[model samples]
Target: MSLTLEQRLDTLPAGAEVAWCGQQYVTAGQLRADVATLAGWLAAHPARHWALCLDDAYAFTVALLACGMAGCVAVLPGHRRPAGLEEQAPYIEALLVDGDWSSAVLSFPVCHWQAVMAAPLSAAPTTPWPAPLSVLMFTSGSTGVPQAILKQERELLAEVEIQAGLWADALAGAVILATVSQQHIYGLLFRILLPLRLGLPLAAATCTTPEQLQAAVRGLMRPWALISSPAFLEHLDPDLSCPGARWLVSSGGPLSASGAALSQRCLGLSPVELYGSSETGGIAWRQQHGSDWMLLPGLTLSVDAAETWWLTSPFLPAGQRWALSDRLVWQENGFRLLGRADRVIKLAEKRISLDEVERRLRAVPWIAEAAVVPLEIGGRRCLGAVLIPSAEGWRLHATLGEGRLLLQLRQALRPWLEPVALPRRLRCLSAMPVNSQGKRPYAVLKELFDVAIEC
Candidate 1:
């Protein structure tokens, strides 16, 4: 039997540790009190839509749960920039933030953490568990504009239940630590929902760098489960001690066989990779030694004539089937993911749109024309950009030298693009590569980057 969010909350003893902030332990009682207090404030203000933009993991978690209890839709944006916030301002009533943004003025009102904490606590609202409240997740948009994927409380709760059962024995009595941000779907599910629902202690700070991660779990005596991504797992220091971890889980992108083997040698456990998307909760997962993925319980899978995978899961809306962007081959137990059917590719575990990167490059004032392609380098995928320089670009290149000019343009584009979307391999061309038929030749354009690209 599955437990509802409300029931799970009730199961945790008030004194049970819920989170560890540095050396301090935050109890379940404290978390509940905070949630109740925030929910009360949200109820009194009564905003139909609220944007959560907190950098602190614990604060973000409280705001998320409070909004659900108050029955207001919570909008989580991938970027915290002013322009990005402005794009969501029309859809949200106000922004909830724990970060400093006092200098910049924004369209919507901002609600700081201090204000929320001072509000009086009310009895936990009568709203039932697994309430009808909705959460809108905006993707990082490696391809183009961020797309919103709507999720209901039930979908989140159900996913937690399914994952809990799948790893019940492995996760029993283990504390949860993570390197991923709670802002994304995988992080939310693995780091927040799973632990909270199962009454496990969670770490407050996300381990962004390997050193931080090593430090966090250094002296911990309790068994731990790490929820991380392929990019982070690829770089773990084998010399470091990760003594208490029972298992390390990777998602957000496929973990290469070598990465998995390296993680096992260094960390003493091979990562369990989950293959899924924000659109469809979690489809399948596999360990490093396995060639095929095994479907989680309660998921139905099919393939169309075009080889695109289709899914109907408990987390998805009833009677609605989702068509995935990846092509797959069906097996009796699960399926084998072949590759993506779309132009989107994963770079450093983040889905990047080649087309979107090209568009942003073309929009750069110094670039007259741009073409972007994905290239594998040193066992990882990265983007390569070929550009036709505008008049301004030519002048800068001649004056500042190629390296300096490239650095300047890269910095300028950071505001409009993500770090992953910025091309690490760039080349400036005299003209577009074309054939006798007057059509651009993709083979030549791709080969230019593989060989020597003339600036």
Candidate 2:
């Protein structure tokens, strides 16, 4: 039987390897010692909320655990930019970071990773932590402004236990490596918490490029599992070789069929795609062979009259049912996801689904990927599209120029789309503007039409 996170923390051998950081292995003893030192410092301070902005996964884990130990709330911002961090200053009283941040830019007290670790070691505490610790994480800001979501320790542990039980066989003796940032919930759970609870050694650095992933994989001598997203998986180099790689997990957004095939061909396995949000810990997951998503254990699902999905899970507060923005088609054991309910917009008194418009645009032979956003031009609301052109599409664009290419695209969409529903402005590019989480921010997409209002 798998042990609880608290039990594992107390029982794991001190000499066991916990993480690989800065080209060296970090032992369990070091983790405990560091946590003790930091927790002591935090206990002495008066701050209630500390914002963690660390870049290294190992450092982030240490700070998080230390916050729990000291009875403090840990706040994780979605972005590392100064402006973004500044916006969170009003909510947090202190900032903990592993990178070099200037004091002139931030308003709160700053704690450097090096300085904290340099302090003398304090004895590890014997008493158990408070029953339920608190953590603050933000949404991806893909659809609108990012919103804060508060999670309790018990809720996160529940999801971790479910995942550990589901993927135990594949993860046994496998090292955890990730290309995603630990700032977000998906990476926080898969890359940090799961590995720790399962007693798996994790790589500290995030692989931001194909070369980095190849290097990390080659350096590992034992089996490894990669926690990644569609943003990094779609651009993998087919020529690169990855040995000792046993499992691949993709989340944050859906992976395309071609991207899944590429992963299977390169990594010698298909990625298990997870579907959920920060608001709801993991709801369902699917493999490349199927389109339906099976719910995780201990979760119940239902749909309302408007076809909106609702979830009841152990991860939520007792007797609370959470409404989801996603539209789904129910099956006996699982369900298929439609688009988001919020993606529907009204233009010229006609309701148009942006997802449907993007799907129609992708069906064109020339367009490879498409995103549609509501745009306001000259005080009139209309639709604008950002497209990544395929090889043939680019060739035609070069030969016939933008005007003719756009005319052909409009003709292609005319069969299924109403005149008012068609995109009023179009911008073709080589790639879509996706973040590290593999989601395109709606505000950023709206800015694509900022320069020319009438385009």
Candidate 3:
């Protein structure tokens, strides 16, 4: 019987199970039942848009799918804070939170996953319609406040073609152990949608640690595709070297050249890098160690006068020359990426803005002027800030010093840069790292940062 998504999921094979990080497993039947139960709770509130703020992947799946089934749109905001909630409240009518429910943050019904799963699957709504503009994935606010990227069912089809076909070399019987999160588009494609749509095996849990990865590999039947980022690859335990897989996939930031070489030597699979973002979804992809890509067979990219990326994609919504922030160098064969047009620095596998870092430092009150520059140390890039305070420079600088200052700054930077890129060296200076328009010149900052560290 040729069936739709709901029908296919409602009757998946009994034996096929999602290995939950090698700790446990959940069958297709259980997943369907969980979604079905939540579908009932969702039916209670109509025309309500809900958000999933919890860290758990499986709970997010159930909540999202249940909302899709009930014809209610779901807004996936990046940062779930009072500010984030305030900005996105206009799009959604309510919020959906898991276990440690925050009554202070939410004004809507806060039901546990257990409560949701126990609830009956009210009246089955009309089968999947034109997506109902259900999901609103926020653009990475690296440039500014996140913008909502509305997605329909067609996104599932788009992801399958771009990501699932290229990186995921999983055969008919093979499974995929996703290291990325499904809440984000990239993760949603590899972890949840592709597995559900194309019938590839997926790990139930989001594996982070190497021990967890080893356990996941031992448990799964096949060498799974590890969906991951450069950050995870760099810090991976050098001792634990058993990641047997068909291949691996990485995105979000550039995979370090050294790390890629190490991964191939250790894990036996060089990651396939994807060049795209939350705004335009995935555009082009290539093998980590290999050169160039097949391109997205049908698409072509061009540059405008100010030198911006203009894309023409068949998979994209009815559009042509969709302008995006990422700039590119169009080579004869494939393409080479520059970086984000914004002032953000894609360093140490994290996306952070130099300006944003400066802004945070000035808010300390004592610091009269502050500027941040991206500097490289030990073949890895790190943040370097030059501060001019009201008090004597040496007094303030000596108090924190370079070593102790790094430890102090890291605490403040947890909200900005990922662990790896926090500054190792601090310098006291009279000025910040910016031009007249308050613009940061990439070349100038890189040179000063390098010189200061060497000094």
Candidate 4:
């Protein structure tokens, strides 16, 4: 039998390849040494919770394992912006970063990851992580605030086991390449833990562009599996050929039918789409667009009188039933998702709360009232904002013109929102379109952006 991740960490041979960093491969020996050294540094620190914001996947894996080894809770904030980190400062004691962040103004002590990795090796032996290890992750809540979700080590391991059991055969002898960030749960599982648990080599850097992905695949000369998102898969050039790819997994949002067909033509494989949320681990998966989603092994689904979905799984805390905002219809073989019952939407594979965007917009001094709606622009989904500006805002808009006024609003929102969550188009309206029931309908709000004079 193959060794589990914990056993492999302790028993893998020194020369075994672990990851591809830059032009060369990082070996098991170096990974162990670096992890040990960093773990020692972390152990010596007084912090109990360390936030990981590294861009390099290799550095992120090293920091993550070291945190586990050192008995600290790892917090992934999903974004590396100073403002985002500041919002998480109350929960985290220190920050672990890889790249140069000299200009970022932060309130917490920063740990330069490269310097610690350069330190002399420690002789400490790797041991099994303590039971019930936890990680803190933040996701946008329906109430327009970032909600913290705690995931136990066992839960993550169970998810890894389920995925490995289902797809390991197809992915055997294949290296992993990804176009997603490790900060999210899906990326953390597929790009990092799954490969580590399966002993498959993973690329240390994320391939953000089609050219980068092509180059990485061509250089590998071996079968590869792509861990990607709907946003990245949608943008892939149909003519771009990736010859050695064997498996492709898409998550974070629903993949359009056209996007799935495009992946089949470009990568020679239809993407296996995963459906779930941070609050719940993976729920179901399907390969064909519009097909019913098959539940993963060991999960039960229940629906309430109002059609809200509830999930009970071993991966959840204590196997308790968790409520979900999605409504589903049961089919003979599986379930079909109707749609979400909340205002939250996925933009560029990032979970965004429309309420949160409106909240931030209303907080701006020049904005009196704000409404946000999802818009599809140039084959991509994004946000559009309709603002009922204050007197001062209207004055500025008249003086600065719509272009400059929109720029100012975007700049004001940069500190609170991710780049992908920011509104791509803006319009200033005298009054919000509301129905007789005093509720703003989504159709009316979306129609405001249909005019040609959008800012």
For all candidates in order, the CA lDDT equals: 0.78, 0.80, 0.65, 0.87
Score candidate 3 by lDDT. 0.65
**Model 3, C-alpha of 159: deviation from truth (Å):** 2.4
- Using lDDT as the measure, what is the rank order of every candidate, best first? 4, 2, 1, 3
Report the CA-based lDDT of candidate 1 relative to the real structure: 0.78
Worst 10 residues of 1 by lDDT: 446-455
How large an RMSD does model 4 have? Answer: 2.0
Question: What stretches of model 1 exceed 4 Å from their correct place?
Answer: 1-3, 99-102, 118-131, 140-143, 331-333, 434-441, 450-455
**Best-fitting candidate, measured by lDDT?**
4
TM-score of each: 0.90, 0.76, 0.80, 0.95
Clashes of each: 2, 0, 0, 0
Q: Between candidates 1 and 3, which one is better according to lDDT? A: 1
lDDT string for model 4 (214-244, tens) is 9998889889999999988888898999998
Ranking by TM-score: 4, 1, 3, 2
- Expressed as tens digits, the lDDT of each residue in 1-455 for candidate 3 is 22345655766886567435345667777777677667766777664688776556667766777777877787776554544466566776777655565345544434466555555546445456334335787754554344577776555556565554554444345566766667677787666766776566567577787777777778764556777877777777767666557767788788777768866866787777887766566788887444654467567777778887688875567764577666666677687766667666676445566665676676665678776767767876777777676675446566866556556655665554345445556666666567788876657755665545431
Best by TM-score: 4
List of clashing residue pairs for candidate 3: none
| Lowest lDDT block of 10, candidate 4 | 123-132
Better model by lDDT, 3 or 4? 4
Model 3, which residues run further than 4 Å from truth?
1-24, 79-94, 97-111, 118-133, 167-169, 237-244, 288-290, 362-369, 388-455
* Model 1, span 1-455: residue lDDT tens: 56655566667899998887778878988888888778778888857688887767778778887887777788877667776677667677888987576556888788888666865556566557436558888763435656778888788888888888888688888878888888788988898888887788888888887788778887456788899988887787767667777878999887877678778876789788898888788988888556689988899887778766688999998789988888877777667777887777888887777777787788888789988877767665777788899998888878987666667767877776677777767777899888999877767777877663222
